[model samples]
Target chain A: MIRIQGLRKFFGRQPVLRGVDLDVATGEIMIVIGRSGGGKSVLLKHMLGLLRPDAGAVVVDGTDITKLRGAALEAVRRRYGVVFQGGALFDSMSVFDNVAFPLREKTALGAGDIAQRVEEKLAQVGLVDMGHKNPAEISGGMRKRVAIARALVTEPEIVFFDEPTTGLDPILVNTIHHLIQDLHRTFRFTAVMVSHEIPEIFEIADRVAMLHEGVIIETGDARGIQNSTNPIVQQFIHGAVEGAHHVA
Target chain B: MTDWSAGRETWPLPARWVEALGEGTLYLVESIGRFGRFLGQAVALVFIPPLKFRRLAGRVYFVGFKSLTIVILTGAFTGMALGLQVFLTLQRVGSEAFVGPAVGIALVRELGPVLTAVFVTGLAGSALTAELGIMRITEQIDAFMVMALNPMRYLVVPAILAGIITFPMLTAIFDVAGIYGGYLVAVMLLGTSPGTYFGQMQAFADMTDVMVGFWKSLCFGGLVPWVCTYKGFHCGHGAEGVSRATTEAVVLSCVLILIFNYFLGSVLP
Candidate 1:
């Protein structure tokens, strides 16, 4: 459902995504694992049209999102939900309002209907009673769930998780993983996740893409990622200090 | 609201005025530079490669409609107060008849324009800065670019257009209310002839004076939001940084309106 070809992006003079390419099919959860500052999040932003590639195209379900503009692009964006890292909830709005934002902004849903859908999505994220609370008032786990509920409020065809479990505790991380698995099974939507927690990868990924030095060196099924002979993959998965995946 | 001990005030007599004038002048220059940038983008929107009219209209409504209630409220109360204060001060001379010309001239030539602009700067200016600052620190502006939308067209142009359309109307409301407040003070409190009061207003009030005030007000309206949004968009850091930018926006807008009033008034005979 997503195709990115020869994607290149840079922040000022530093080249981030250097000619990367990848594709994922419908109803599959594709996890991208890489070290910090390795262009994983940059790659995700490019796919969402939240950041443009310096060269090439990011096609979501056949539309070249890099070419879409203004309301048209916003319309395209409404097709997918995004769970931003740190759960970038609006501080001024309540949890219910935060989840209802995309629906309110992008759709013509009446107040009662929006309230109903927001309640249902909040329940799915196990945040039933927390809707009245502000984002700062909630726990990190609950905040992440609020973010998830907000993302799903639009009933998007695809979802992007930008390091969903990065700041959570181990127990909350498992909760998020189970939630991801359950949602993937329940919603049957494509999931493009950026993560580094190795064990969590085994539980949630249908396929894994390994990004190294601004390139995707390996792309394989869940089991393929585990047994691959590529030295970079071995060093990374085993937490080894000496290998093709060098420190610094 | 009137706490004298919130923070220490160390400014001496001569130094205080100097700081006020200096800070006011510095903000005027900075505000002009930012306003230039906004005008450049807004003007370019007229001839740009791709024009987004609907998005631009939405932004205009944001700048104009959302700010309506505040502008009107400030105008009404300010007019009433100016009317009462100026009449009482002039009552000692027993030339209370001059109250008509005094109120009309102040409202039409200087006070009305300057006060409304300052009020808007405090109201719309701060909001603009905070809104854009949050968007900047959060990378929403970057997100717009990623979506291949020009931030200039989608954001700045509409605000400028709205200010142009809204400020003149607000100033007119200010002028009418201010003069009426003066009448209430003159006829009711000081027992002046209503006929002579209004007749003097009609005689002294020139089209030139009213026209210049409205024109200057429109210019201030555009300048305030333009500078506020520009500063916010280019701000550094997160919440604290955004908050500082907002404070500066409000302070600078008030200063610039006064500065613009002097220059624009100088040009008006």
Candidate 2:
């Protein structure tokens, strides 16, 4: 389980996250939804130990990751797989090498094993024959798939996705969502994804958390969140412009 | 003139100048502090375990071997120009024999290392900044960090150590090419006796002169990449940021090289 307690963050005196508290149970997909610039990505980063909170404890399975440093911190990070917004594929590397990077760096696997594992991950992501191409040669959606393959190549215990479907076309977005759901069902990795795809994301998320005004105002199952009475939640969910959120 | 006083009346000119000066000073100090911290981290990480020799070797090839032709050409041209000019000036005084010594000493003591450093800064340093800047904007650096890899170790240490290893070697090549070019001009073109030209250079240009060039190259090697990579690592948002960082890296590396060359020339024997 992942527990965030009293998490607060300030970027240059402007509060981005204010006393955010949340929890993610084991093997569940928790989708964090918010307006653009509401710090959803920042929250994901905090959980990954990429950014330390001003005041909070990110306890991962009883260990407070916020206080860990050096190798201790690295050990925690090694268990996590993150798919960044832009795929963040190494430009200098081919798709195959990009997917193979984590395994080559972290494990003592031999060349044959590494190749086999990389090929398996690529095939799982439906990019088996495209491994030799550079990331720049691939489409944006394909790049995201490559990123996902790289992330899961290490068989991490938890995976984080930041704006996974932000820039893709509608069809591609649905395809990506379905792919993510399929992978989650197969791997059963505790998944935390920040996205704004609305009704589509609701199809895959077990729980949806609404982040507003630097805090999680509401969190519940997708159906419960959709039927919530809170004006801010309603405004965000229904894409209403005139509401408490707009007034504030 | 009627409205100039009103606009200028917000503050005295001297005060405005002082404020600008203060801001510039603060920026400079902050940059120096950041550069020093990065250097310390890079140096410390260089000795750590899991040294990536493949990356280091690639950087060495890129920074040193790839720069050979340009360094050689620059050294040859500069030496030829110096030899010609010195021979002409010494001809008036019936001391043309000293042309070889003048050219050799200047090349060995100063121009060889300093020019090589400037060229490499323009070539490799700018490339490093642009490459890493793109990575920064594209989030590759953050990806490395997220993967439990230290960017300082994996990206920076190899590039820096490569610079340190390559600078002196390139400077030596520059010096040798420069001396040969000087010999070619003084003996073959200017009709100076080969014996006197070589004898005068041998008499005056000692190991200390070459050592000075080596030391300067070593410092320049470390400094250029240090500034370039730091700018790249901290580059800002997008394409504009990458371009700005690359420009800053090149300008700062060149400025630092010239400044340090002056100091080293003054201090070294």
Give each prediction's DockQ, rounded to 2 decimals.
Answer: 0.08, 0.41
lDDT of 1 by residue, B1-269 (tens): 13332332675678767766887899989867876766786777858655566756675676666766776666666666776776788778867677788788888889887887777777777887888888777655653443334667656766666677777777888788778777776777667789878888788887988888888878987888677777787777878999899988888778878788889898877
Q: Which candidate is the best by DockQ?
A: 2
> Candidate 1, which segments miss by more than 4 Å at Cα?
A108-110, A228-235, A238-248, B1-107, B122-124, B139-202, B230-269
Q: What does the interface RMSD come to for each candidate?
A: 13.5, 9.6
**Docking outcome class, model 2:** acceptable
- lDDT of each residue in B119-172, candidate 2, tens digit only: 998899899999999999888998998899998887888899899999999999
Q: Which pairs of residues clash in candidate 2, taking residues 3 or more apart in a chain or in different chains?
A: none
CA lDDT of each prediction against the hidden true structure: 0.80, 0.91
Q: Output the worst ten-in-a-row residue range by lDDT, candidate 2 chain B.
A: B1-10
* TM-score computed on alpha carbons, candidate 1: 0.70
